[model samples]
Target: MKETAYLLQAALISAWWVGLASNGVFFAAFQFDAIPSTAFWAFFAPDVILIAALSTVRAYKQNSAIELVILGAFAYASLYCVNATVLTASGYLPTGLMLLGLAYNGFLCFSDSAFRVSSTSMTWNAIKTLIQTVCIWTMALVIVPYVILDAFDTFALPSMDIWLIIGGLLFACFSLLGLTSAFFMVRDGAGTPLPLDQTNHLVVSGPYHYVRNPMAISGIGQGLAVAIIFQSVPLLIYTALGVLIWQLVVRPIEERDMTRRFGESYVQYCRHVSCWIPTFGRRGT
Candidate 1:
């Protein structure tokens, strides 16, 4: 059953990547009339970076699920980017900085893959796969309503005159920082890799000092950045949903397993650190 699950995940992820590459090419083929909206540029362009990064890392070893997921994310981003091009032309796309951050992090995910010298125990990482399955569906389901409403916001809902651009830029900067921290933590061995996963270490340093789950926080930040850039109310709602799901549903399960495996040290670390949010105090000072 475990192997079956892994194979299924691998197949799904591979299909996703292939689709992403195909659509990415299609999206690139069409030229935008104006500066692509921040939303479009932020989410769409960096997908290649993510694909390359994940592929490079996976090449070091074979990780079916992780590979598939990285590919799947790129495909999803590609599709989103194609839509962003249309929205940008219509002048409805709201932000760019957030998109830039997304691209930057995507690059980091790839570049960080350059560092792995050996393989280690990634036992019981299947729990993460289960969490991911739930998380992805949750994200999609939560974002759908907003997408529908946003699709017709121009015709049905009144477009707010709020400064979404500023918010989007702020979001992008935050995401960039988060991604940088996450990359460094993994690349530098601040954290160990989850068993069986082909990424990096557990990453309990730098940004991880403040938040036990920097990557998850960064993911939420990225999602929020997208919402702010586009000013998509639905995406905003989904961002909130994503945060809650990650915090409430996902982290607890992973942490329990991690704590059991890592023992008292993991518990001690958890004492000083926050899960989704970063702590400001200096460590061991």
Candidate 2:
């Protein structure tokens, strides 16, 4: 059963990458108002480079199901970018293809056995996480800024300045860091970052050695970066509120759960690491 699941996942990911590359070529062709066959190769070349780069990273090995999911997500996003760009350029929507791609991607994500738990439990947890992500991101990035802050009229996108570049770099770095932290939970702790499938072991290595909640830092950092890049005060306020809520409500509950699960080992780790601030040179627990 496990081998079958692995094979299915591999096939889905392979299909997703091929679709993504083809879509990129279509996007380039549309942008240039031409459909030269060479455009396909041009787009495919970058995918080859990207795959090679991912291959060099041990975390992205074939056995790492979660890492493969991450790569699949990137491919899915690339397809979306191509679709969106084509639509904007031509003022036409590939609604059927878009829906099909979305359904297929959703199937790939849910069908994979990323957790050791029962299939029903994993599906439930994944659905919960998906809903939570959509809600949180929409509120922070869209609703708060557009509806509440009147961002459409109040703020404009920032010019391509040093601050904008810095914000982009920070967002990219923190996003990767957060994903890496989650990967560690899966690889080292034999679990996930979700509360329902919480890590079994105390993750003291990687970013956790420096700070208690690197994931939260990454979330807040990305939010702040987006706010700065778009010059949206409301988005910045939303980001701050998110951090405050996590610190006040979420962190306490998570710490309690950790203490209950890990007892003295977690307590010792907490004593050594700061909650938010990164403390270099402090010996890890």
Q: TM-scores of the models, in the given order? A: 0.44, 0.51
Q: Backbone clash tally for model 2? A: 0
Tens digit of per-residue lDDT, candidate 1, span 92-134: 2221212432443343234324333223323323344345535
TM-score of model number 1: 0.44
lDDT of each: 0.49, 0.58
Lowest lDDT 10-mer window, candidate 1? Answer: 91-100
lDDT of 2 by residue, 115-232 (tens): 2331334444455445655665575555545543331245565798987998899889987887777666556665556654566577888888899899888889988888878767
RMSD values, in order shown: 14.3, 16.9
> Runs in model 2 with CA error above 4 Å?
1-152, 155-158
Residue 66 of model 1: what lDDT? 53
